[model samples]
Target: MKVVEQIKAPILDEMETFEQKFSNSMSSKVALLNRITHYIVNRKGKQMRPMFVFLVAKMLSDNEKANERTFRGASVIELIHTATLVHDDVVDDSNMRRGFFSVNALWKNKIAVLVGDYLLSKGLLLSIDNEDFDLLKIISVAVREMSEGELLQIEKARKLDISEAVYYDIIRQKTATLIAACCSLGAASVQPNSVHVEKMRKFGELIGMAFQIKDDLFDYGETAIGKPTGIDIKEQKMTLPLIYALNTATDKDKDWMINSVKNHNKNKLRVKQVIQKVKDLGGLEYAEKKMLTFKMEAIDILQQYPNSDYKSALELMVNYVIDRKK
Candidate 1:
């Protein structure tokens, strides 16, 4: 079986049930909205977020049985996450996502924006109506962090001089925060007043940190792990490898790298050269080391949990975050 399938084995029933709940959460009275949501549901990715929710919930629940709140939490997360992606496609003017045409590409930006808003409201109402205040707090904070992270990256993009510290801050808010919410929500759904919520949140944050670093590494690698190699340079996104390369480079080389990113970003040759420079500077090696560090820390967090299918699946997920090709 595929690794994702393997990781999902223990939670197969919950995943299937969650899918129905997720579909119901997206329902609307308007036909157009229904059509669009149907499309979105059909084109869904790996559903890793909900998997995290169920795995953590089941692991921590009294009888290894995830309750109704767990399903609702997972649905709320996926709903809000989809809302963000729709808005992101509009903002980035992206034509495709996961090999399918983006919502903006199909319905135009105005409709896409409205759809995003609708999804956002649906997610929020799901929590508010259910009085899942603690869960809402967790997801709300993540959304705020995501918006801040995106804006921060835009501001830093202008400078092209992001420090390693700033770089970590960006990814933590941008990518890690949502996954952290997932794990925390997982624990919260099962045990409202337990410290495991915080523990799982930190665990998920480590996995998310490693996950984003792995994504950054793909930009300099020969393999296409969700995007083209050197695309980060072409788009002038300051990833960890490039940041490390710039920090350690001589004044002349550093100046050249910045110039290439700022001005020659569109030129294929210059982008390739920049990728090679980053590689030669041990940028990739340094990033891989950091990625492993997060992975180990996440694994260590699980050391306190006893042996079980849920814990085992969670471990597989941590490794899969760094090991998956795309």
Candidate 2:
């Protein structure tokens, strides 16, 4: 099996636990909760956040007690991640995700929005049961970061003039914050040292940053990961690669891209032209180099931990950021 698949085996067990926790707490006899759960399972995201929690726990303490604590932590992270996706689809008006209809696409915006809230509430309730106040704080802060990230993106979306720094800040909060939370919570399960916790958090933040950059770069590539290539451009949202390139591009190139991106006309050629210009100006390559640097930084942090399969796996996951085509 591939490395990603290998890392997934333990996380799958935690996902089951997350489901049971939610199912037992649910009050209504309505099938709505079941339907929502089923939709989430069918979507089957890569479960990266959970893996971070598990891996960090394993590296910190290779014991059964640590394992169980890590399992619960991973479950919380996954729940939080799923809730974000539900809300994201509604916000983006996206019809498809992971090559299937989004929950919003099938159930409409109102249901999707409510279901997202339900998931978040359920996650909070489950978190409280664990009585890990520190864990709860970590998750709560992550949710706050996620919201701020979304709001920042929205504000930037309204204005066509997005700076490279602003775009990266948005992504860091939106995507990296939760991953960093996972690492911090996981480290807390084993080590109480603030230094180790900070290191783990740094590791997660760097890896998460690389992951999102790769995702944005994938948009411009002709790969399965590039499915929503022109979506950001069409929606007039500036991602990191575009923002960086625009800052560096020749005035003519920038003008062409600005006009094409701002245009609401359904001319495929216009989007293509901007994409070509982006590629020609080395936007994708610059992003790739940055991703490599982040990945390396993440791996460097792992070296402080004792060598183990768990540590090795975390190192491998760093490379997987660039390797993952989707």
Candidate 3:
């Protein structure tokens, strides 16, 4: 079945409400924070974080109470995500995000940092108001892991010596950890049991890993989206596919590829050369196959649960996560 057909409309409707709730919380700030918040709102994102929260909650409990609680929780998750993006742009010195002028780019690094801090404070305050200690703990842990992951990636970036295992570990920590937390928090909202929570968390982790690897793959793979391919190679970060390709490359090819990444200037011409080299080395193809494996692993986990619209939707989301055009 087509993945979109498998995602029930009811879940999407609920997610819309979650988006509104999350956006409303960012309101009432001063001009700069308000503008940055609105700028973020204007740019489109899949709202995937909240979707995961709502989907997991629906699987365990489909009642009105559960839905409401999960929506609130999901909004919190999205807010945290937004806060991170604001900070990430500043750190990356990025000029754009989601195809819009980034806060840092539009305003300045100092203002962007302040805006990020405000968003984080708001998220924390909301979490506290909800009085869910577990939720607070999850956010705290996720932030810690995210910071560590970013630092680790920065430290290891551009080094061709990076292995596939280390590549997976970095993505898992930086991208997957928070996604896993969303599912875990959603399940906990209803069941609050370890088994179900852990199951959903694991499912999210695997899917999140695939989701990001696929994103990285697009930097080399065929992309319909306007995302410039091989940006990471230009940035010198050795992602999973590159790591795998390097491991399997011919000795001369490996040496040349390594030199290409390390020695190339940030100019467009050199970046294109490295991209062509990656394509020749089959890095993009290897990443696609690996992404498919993780997507299937996520689907396999849903097999443990009974057949339901929620389970089906979760399965559909797994496919959507990797196959998304943008």
Candidate 4:
């Protein structure tokens, strides 16, 4: 079986149940809304966010069975995350997601934006109705950070000058915050008010950091990682590897790279040369090392908990974040 399947071994039942809960939570009175939601649900990507919620809850739960709040937490995260993705598609003018036509592609942008707002409201209501304020707070913060991260990236993208510190800040807010919420929500659902909640939050944040770095590495590919090489440079998204290369380059080389990324980004040959230059300047190696560091730090947090399938699955998750090919 694939590593993702293996990671789900311990939480298979919870995941199965969470599916029904998640679908139910999205139910709407309007037929059009329901139809759009059905499409979203059917085309969902790997349910990694909910997996984090269930795995952490079960790992921390005494009976290994998740409670109502855990299910609610998973549903809320999914709803909010889906809303963000829908809005993102509209913002990016993207027509495809996970190989399926996005909501805006099929239904149009105006409807898609409304659908996103509907999902956001649904997520907020699910938490408020259940009085899961703690869980709601976590998701709220993630949404805020994700928006801030996107804006921060855009603000920096124009000038094409992003320090390593700014790069970390962007990924942490854009990607890491959501994963952190998943782990923390899991812990809060089971072991509320304990240090475990904060611990799991940190664990997820580290894994998220590693995950984004791995994603950045894909743009400077050694494999078929779905996206085309140097896409980040083409878009002027200052990812880690390129940033590292820029940081280490001589003045002349730095100008050349900046010119390549800024002015000649549309030129395939220049982009290819930029990719090769990043690799030659040790950018890829530096990024891989940092990714592994975050992965190891995440694994260290799991050491405090006793042995369990849930814990083992979480460990597998941390490794998978860094090791995933795409």
Stretches of candidate 2 off by over 4 Å are 9-29, 222-228
Q: Which ten residues in a row have the lowest lDDT in candidate 1?
A: 220-229
Better of 1 and 3 by TM-score: 1
Model 2 RMSD, rounded to 1 decimal: 2.8
Ranking by TM-score: 4, 1, 3, 2
Per-model TM-score versus the true fold: 0.97, 0.88, 0.89, 0.98
The model with the greatest lDDT is 1
Residue-level lDDT of model 2, residues 1-326, one tens digit each, is 98787765545555566556534443346698677677676567666776788778877875743455566666666676778888999987999989999999888999999888877777787768877667777888888998999898888777678887887798889888888998998897677556777788888889889988887876687366455366667767787778877888889878877777777425777877777778877888888888899898888888877888778778778888768867
Model 4, stretches more than 4 Å misplaced? 224-228
Global local distance difference test of model 4? 0.92
Worst 10 residues of 4 by lDDT: 221-230
Give candidate 1's error at residue 156 in angstroms: 0.7
Score candidate 2 by lDDT.
0.77
* Candidate 4 structure quality by residue, lDDT tens digits, 155-231: 99999889999999999999999999999999999888899989999999999999999989999874464444788
Tell me the lDDT of model 1 at 202: 98
Error of 2 at 10 (Å): 6.9
Model 1 earns a TM-score of 0.97
Colliding pairs, model 4? none
lDDT by residue for model 1 over 149-183, one digit each (tens)?
99999999999979999999999999999999999
Question: Candidate 3's residue-wise lDDT over 1-326, tens digit each?
Answer: 54554574548677667668878888863776777788788795666677788878888885853455576677677777788988999988999997788899989999889888888888888878877667767767888988888888888873556777877888888999999999988998787756888888888899989989878877764578644567787778877767876788789978877877787746677777767776777777888888899888888889988888888788878878887875
